[model samples]
Target: MAKRRITQETFDDAVRENMEEFEMNPEDALRDAVEQFESQGVDLTCIVKAVPAVSSDDKQEEQTHEVLKALDSLRIGKDSAAVADVTADMKCFTEQCSVGFAQRYLAAQKDAYPTILSYCKKSVEEQDSVLTALSALAALTDGQPDLLDAEGQQFLLDVLKKHQADSSVTCVAICVVRHCCLKHEQNRQDLVKGGLLPLLTRAITQHSGCAELIKQASSALRVMTFDDDVRVTFGNAHEHAKMIVLEHNGLKILIDSATAHPNNTSVLSELCATLARLAVRNEFCQDICDLGGLKLIMTLLADSYESAVVYNNNNKELVRQVLSAIRAIAGNDDVKDAVVSAGGVELIVIAMNRHMTNPTVCEQGCACLSVLALRKPNNCKAIMENGGAFAAVQAMKAHSDAINVQKQACMLLRNLVARMHNYSQPILEMGAEVLIAQAVQTHQDCGDVGKAALRDLGCQVELRELWTGKHGSLAN
Candidate 1:
């Protein structure tokens, strides 16, 4: 990526080198750096103030400091009269008038947070001015969400709810809430209580045409779904990404978004992830199947795999979620038949080969095959015909270090061999026994893998014995 035109004051020269070294763009690098700094209690507000005076190398040293507090503060020139004028006429929030005053007040005035929240409430109708205030609030409170007291957090959420119609205002509002909720447990709780999830989902569905707005809303929804409670809530609505999203027919909205913006890979990738998360529960399986979930996900799977090797704009994230969601959906008997009939098993094996080195996809692919293999009497035969058994064993051998792959590989083979048919020959040709023995030895610490590996070996041995008993064994 080319260099982003950051203001010289806010831009660190060495950050460019760090970006190259980390193989990330400017935005991701800065976000990561800020997160690392925040974790160590570093007062970024002070660092921003001290950047001009400090050397780059010395500043680099400061990044690793064990202790950081607001020991330095930005100097301010705003008088009380200017602040009073802005308070009286909300339009004065332009340029540095509002931003500068906010910086000064945050640094010097103890009552800065309360006063700013009240000021924002005054001109909430001024979308542009409210955005400016939110920006200032983010700068002041990114490293310390506590500064955005209960009232401030509520005000920010309210800002999002009120301006859901105005994409620009809601975009900034979403950014403000995301910043506040960055690693702040209390703030996330406040958001959940403030009805952030449903409101954001509504905004996403209502504003599907607005790319930037959908991007921000989906990003925030993804962040909030990190909580287990939130995941369960999302899993409740049949096929909906989250519980809150279902309130506005979020699933249909997702399908509509996918249909309308087929080329928007970013939004689609995020949507895939949300779907994967919601597919965790068994109740959601039939709903997803009925809604053409298998067919939709299969398209993404093929596209992600083909795009990964051939295109620069491949969405690996979409691949990961497609695999995971398939694993969840395939767990159900009905969805399993639907997936197999749609040639989903073959696509899964292809994806595993395509992303052999991707541990996440490899693991999920093996698990999905296991579900497919055990789905019905015909499934094992179908998997063997599609060469899924060999593909699974190959994945296990290739990604031996991935415990999940090992466990799921053992599972798929076990399910296939339970029928004790043509699966054994293909599996053994792929040296399934050797890999299972290795898993048993290598993953002794991982009880699930080791135990499954042992059980599979026993099943294969019994199968060989039965084959020999049925027909005279000829070494030839």
Candidate 2:
């Protein structure tokens, strides 16, 4: 037989016969009959109204319950299948969920953080559990670190103290500390004063063989000592950060680590940054020199510009730290001579030209040059010969908003004019006087420096009398 065609009546007749034979529901028979028609050439959009629906609110409520259950699994001294399941869910939430989910979950789990802390606090021997707990804590506190309560704060410090021997634990603890103190100044002070500074240095010493651990410790130190306020904020009578420089032997630790591993530029950069942070005060600067910290930094800088190692770009940050540390150390005349002797002047000039747009580099470079030029005729001659005057003024104009750069440039120019012999002629040739006036007219903070520079050049500043009391820029 060729082909047999079935009408809608015939298909319905067959479906009804089958349904009666099978005792199927009449609705199921009709629906299956319609699906058979659709298999050929049917547009079901007109035939179907909608499919069955599930409640998203129900799913969300269930998920919320799961989160709550997970949090509950994190009770103190608890390590079971439930704890692992909760950890897995928390990991997923931290990694894949949104901030809304995090906030909601965190709000629901009133005791999760402390309980997790307590759970891990006793399991120092179980590195994996401790690591998991720490990672979970990090995820939970990423953007919500301010949610860390006083107990949680002390709990973290205790974790560090308890697990200081384990490099992995130390690494996690440092990461936790870094995120906690990143923008929270008071917390940073509390942790440091609580003896975290000395602990960091000791870790640096103990974990010299572990690159990752050292890197983590160095990074934590850098973050803690990063800000200007943190640099000056001491924890004890040791005058705050000076404890790091003096009492804790932080300077020596950094120097030794950098020397031990020359290729680890990340560690070197962070370590140098920590040193720079502590090198703010004169005693710290002198300490840096005494401990040969300056030499270490200068070597790192020279290496960045001269290294053939396949990863030279890694040293740019090291160069930045070196410049900043040198600027601070150069405040003293003895150290200034040492910097000049180390060819720091040429390096600063090169860095200035290389990083013409980086305001921090320019600021520190100019400040270092200014300090090197103070009361030193030969160093002034070096700066003048290397076109430092041109670089300084250009930096001032380029970053008019950078008060530090402007002040340093003004001071450098002032020293070049007043301290150096016959330096006024080159400054005039370099068109520095106009920049000086512009610097003063523009920056009220550095106006006195600008006017002093102008006067040193023997140029009658437009506001000559304003510098004394009528106007004040800033102290030299």
Candidate 3:
């Protein structure tokens, strides 16, 4: 061969000639081009551009079909590198392709789902990576109800069943099932029947990795428990809640973890919220109250970190759940005294003041305060003495925009006036009359507030009747 000096033109012409041979295997061509660029120090981008593009309409469709087939095969393969590359390609294609291309790519690869599931089951160390890919795949098919048919649903359930004991796998499996359950009621049912609750209960006590896995597992359980089909499935959730509180020392662990990892707001919030739900009606409330659950929650609510904002939201929810728990346990005068001594009222007042803009927080804080107020008349008096009445009344008038907040505030006001009529004097001094007037005027627009304000007003009038023997006139 004559001495042919290599130039950019020569390299470009070589790549173009190879690319023009349509009979050549595309993967082989790509591999050869990559190797040539590596040897010649040529920019791969230039080589890629120089390659001939499939031009004929039929050839273009065929090339597209071939790529899809390759993706489907790679998705099913055991080769991690190949699977990762194909997954990346699929993700890019989904983002850049036409709707028709996306639909075909998703639908035409239904046969490969089993392989995907197998990869999920086999990739022990890379479980999170695989799960991330599975999540994306599930999202693609989420809008297509029939994309994940009975077979696909069954495959997911199989993975859950197989890896229920592996914490990492269980975490990913939960997310996969959660994605599948978004629009499919049947998949939701399948997840429950596949023993999700037992797995979650086990994970709550057993999963020993970073707290994130536990939190994610707990969150998944929470989501599953909300489904009507799965709600009844966790028939033992109440019993389990009691077990968590009494047997596992769950309240103590949650408090410690929340305090230690205050920066991991999501984990801390989930753990606390889960504990609160568990403590709902269990006799364990007394144990938890004795173990400082209330104090821990209050401390978190008072913290100034961003996590505190999360804790504030979750604390409001916990307060609602723990209200019944508080009533059941704090019925004892001594326990009631401890709640006050622990600064529960002051914390409630602070949460009310700080999170007034969050209606749920205001409602839950007010509800908890009402419980404390009813149980301990002295504590209620302390609240009034400390300007809580003004905050409560402010929440009632301004926060009336939220029905729950209005209801909770009205209920607290009613309890205050009913149990400690003496506090009503201070309440009136704090513009209680004006606030109540505003509430009555706007009550009709809010459901819970309207009903609650009417009930509270009637109760106050009824008390006046009982005291003075006059139905319509006040003793004054």
Candidate 4:
């Protein structure tokens, strides 16, 4: 049977009743409340289970800390609140939440979710209060996704629906939605069912000129396409991905947005990442290629690298995201050749060589090459000739401890040798055999792929047998 649970308000009311009516001490009251609830089979996991002190002289209530006190201040009748008071209280709550996770976790434990949610619901009509209240909610829900109940999800969708034309409000609302949907599967489902796809795509189309809004909207759209919730085993991530592309024209909107933000690397990076997320189907991958996505991505890749001379760190991320998008789009066979024909192989090799120290860039770079060389023997020769083979070997050596880099390098080596046997000897001459052996020895997950690469490169690999064909059980 499911366990019975009580709200923080109910438990606090019980503790107060024990102290004020029964003349019990604070400790005794707390103990009595705990024992009573446990005896009634009520779960106290989420309840704060504490009593605040009362100032007898002024009859004012004292909370555990300033954040709780601020939350308490906002709990008064919503209609009686002056605009100035609401603004100040929201700022205080938001500032406290911004300090650290300790304050945010405490506020969440003390039922601050409903209080701030109520403020958001009430302040929807007033523009200033709406942004202020939404900002507070955003800060509060940062690391506390569980606090986003169904009502909170509905409120977020309603905010987007009413304020779709208002860029400022829509940006803040999308920020909150991103916070809630990340790592929370149910919120993603609830929001999607509430018609979130069209709103997000429309926001991107309407605010294509606004870089900040575009980034936020693109990120929220990507979050919908993630299967990242830990509590639930299965999610409709693929369904959501398809919905975004097929039903909402997410491909065109994102591509157009990326085209609009030529100088803004951050916006371009986000759009590229979203593009990767939406390319879950073969047709979608072809659609991306059909929609001039390949040309746009190649342009962004070159532009971001050139701009990296001043901002290396920021542009490194852009490079990684762009490479990831390239890898995703290259899942199609025809697009694979298109990428190579458009100087993608040389550019990708250059990007990998430049960002050799960044493991993610190297990983994405090798994965992209592996996909490009999957069935095309000509492409494998191209990768080997353009210093692609040398780049992969150096990436493996530079970030030897990075398992993803090692795994992708192994896959790339295997793909290169899987079709053409001559290139393996040249690749093995680069001392790749030692790296493949080391990866197999260090990472258990890399055993199969590493061994396959070794075997394809004309190196000896041990084969293990675990099953005997003679029926029954091993014990028998």
Candidate 5:
């Protein structure tokens, strides 16, 4: 049976009922409410699950929650508010918004978007309040991308332009840009046109030593390359990505940044992911190689293997990002040979084996091998000899529910035998056919690629004919 669900208000009311009517304490009430809901198979992950605390007052004034109180403190009845007042109000709103999604949502419902945006506009001329205002705006738009409209986009770009030299301000400003452009296509395009790319790349170059600033700027640059807005038919993601690489010299900047911060896993991971996003063309792929990106990536991948015994989340994420970078840069035919020669194939197999439980790592590992095996018979030989094929099949078996893993495994198996048909029997011996068939049956997105893999492996595939007759006969 499907699990039941409840709204945050309903769950909070139940907790409040236990506390008020039954004379239970807050902790006991919350615990009882949780136990009761979960016992009935209700999901409470979205519920705040905490009793709202009201502010104390000397008089008999109405009680208000923390977020509401913080929001109310921002409405000063003056054209030119004091700097201290503005700073204090901004800090309070930022603190409340940073607590959780519930606070941010409540503030948004109370029309916090325009209120905070007004402060952003007002702070444009007041450099003293730039950081705090930008920080508050960043927090307010964390999961609320729709709050960013044309005016907010202009404000963010203005902040980036004004505070380009100040790493502290640029860091928070770029964070705001990242939040706004995350899933908003128009905002991304407008900001990019407003010269956000140059500011972001410049921030990285000027603040190479500042790990936090570099990480935030790198993430913002990557956000520009995303095509995530679902309402539009197409976005300028490819154009933005190429602009970052070609016009802004993004490849060399990121590579140099990674070289500078070799020991910082988080910064390196962001740099690597951004590099993967910017490698849109064949020459760009080669540019990464010529800029010494391959050696840097290989070194990072090797270093990650050393910490395999005490594998943690950061290590897992770093490995995933590095492998994705390798997969993306290997799109070039010459780079494919280079990767195989540099022991990349073996390292990928080991990464898959080490982080076997992580579906994302497995997905990237299989995808890296798939790219390496494309049209290169010698690389295919290297993969199978180094247990790449076996590891991919194992990843498929282990992460059967991961559609990306299944798809990449099928692509890798097909790429293995596409040029070197002799490798088909060996791969099929590892049960590739069964997994591909299962993927085809389970995931609708995996139908074409999975069946192609099976067909190449000499397994029977029932090719369906959805229509017959001339090409444009349906129009008639």
Candidate 6:
């Protein structure tokens, strides 16, 4: 007889003839066939055609058939090494397929998930790559979101707690727990009660080599600790922010990091800004001030070249963040004086001049200047004497075009004139009367500054005469 072609008929005949021998281990039999096909360069189309068709009564077999079909579609050619290359892709595809099957199977069988979970636990130990097994398990949990019944959830929690220290597993486990927590408030409480917080804290401290993992864990911890329910569960965890600031000497770290790696400007800026906001509370400001946060902020302002390049394209946010931090620090008199002594005023003035066309920065700079002026009346007077008042009044007069900038600049001017009526003298002397008269003329509907200018005019003897022009006519 002619040598039999290794078609589906021959393959099925060969399996049937040895059915009793391999009936106890069909998976092993399939693996052997797949390996043989690899070693002998057998035709997969014939082998695939030979595999017995799954019956409708066997849903698991049906899913396996679908998975095999998916695997076949990914086949590049009849090559064997192609099998190994497709392993990861096949695993991912089957993992997703199993999730939908598991959900439907659980609902149909009523207790299928727990049974499969138990089998998974027993077999996971013998698996060559536990990561793959764990990934499948995580997928099951995600798919049958409700499948982690109390016992199943406890089983998962136990696994997580047992391997919580395993850096490789911790990241995956944290992700699984994060997903679970997001599903419900009760799940969040369960995670905290199950000791996820301490696990995350330890991971952050121990996984120093894994920057991405540490960042993710830190982000998760931030979310959990700030969660309304978790907050009450882990009472006063927010207070730990202050402790981190103090213990880490976060200000110095931020300044050094930002200075050293200007590319990481946003990270450092956010850190400094967050610390500054936290420090604004009465209990923390003094400690922040004592920790040299004020000095660091002033240093940032003084060393403009360092931050300037990073902020050249987007100075508005950078300036606002820095100014906010400075303002927080400047709420302390000693810090304000330190800022001025560190040349903060001049740097701010330069930035203001550079960003004059950028109304938001102009407004922020004007506001900072206003703060400095309020803090140092002599500084306010000197600013007017040195032509700072003209720039401010010009910005204020142009408020109609950019209302926010105009409003801030006007408020600054109003504040300056209120603090030191003498400051208005130089402003009025520099044709501020013309600007104010024009603002009154153009923005008769302007509320705050319109009223403020009227009030300032009522206070100024020369401006009052200038407005009346010595004969009760508007200033020329």
Q: Which runs in model 4 stand beyond 4 Å of their true positions? A: 1-64, 77-79, 471-476
- What candidate 5 gets wrong by more than 4 Å, as runs, is 1-49, 57-60, 77-80, 86-89, 121-128, 470-476
Q: Put the candidates in TM-score order, highest first.
A: 5, 4, 2, 1, 3, 6
What Cα-based lDDT does every candidate model obtain? 0.63, 0.70, 0.56, 0.88, 0.87, 0.54
By lDDT, the candidates rank as: 4, 5, 2, 1, 3, 6
By lDDT, who's the top model here?
4
Once model 5 is optimally superposed onto the true structure by TM-score, how far is the C-alpha of residue 380 displaced, in angstroms? 0.6
* Model 2 lDDT tens row, 1-476: 33334443345464565566877666677677667766765543322211212225574332223334455545432554333445675564344313343343443246566656655555545677678777767666654556566776777788778878888888878777876776666677788767788788888898887777777777777666545333445433235466666677777788788776888777777777777777767777877888888888778777776664543456566677788888778877888888888888888888787777878778888888888998899888888888889899789778988888888888888888776648888777778877777777777898788888888898997664534564555686
List, residue by residue over 1-476, the lDDT tens digit for candidate 4.
88898866688788889988999998999999999999999987655556764524555544355677777778774557844576877798899888777568778887788888888888898788889999999999887778898888888889998998899999999999999899999999988999998999999998889999999999999999999998999998999999999899999989988777788878888999999999998889999999989999898778766755664676988889989999998998998999999889999999998888899999999999999999999899889889998999999999989999999999999999998998888999999999999999999989999999999999999968778777776684
TM-score of decoy 3: 0.61
The count of residue-pair clashes in candidate 3 stands at 0
- lDDT-superior candidate, 1 or 4: 4
lDDT of 5: 0.87
Which has the better TM-score: candidate 3, or candidate 5? 5
In model 1, the runs with Cα more than 4 Å from the true position are 1-123, 133-149, 176-189, 228-242, 305-313, 419-422, 459-476
If scored against the real structure, what TM-score would every candidate get? Answer: 0.67, 0.73, 0.61, 0.86, 0.88, 0.48
Superposed by TM-score, candidate 1 places the C-alpha of residue 403 at a distance from the truth, in angstroms, of 2.6
- lDDT per residue (tens digit) for residues 288-326 in model 5: 999999999998999997855798888899999999999
> Candidate 1 — worst ten consecutive residues by lDDT sum?
66-75
For residues 212-325, what per-residue lDDT tens digits would candidate 3 score against the true structure?
A: 666766565444434334324344445445554555556665555555455554575676556556555535556666677766555555553323445454545544444333
Q: lDDT (0-100) at residue 374 of candidate 2?
A: 87
Worst lDDT 10-window in candidate 4: 55-64
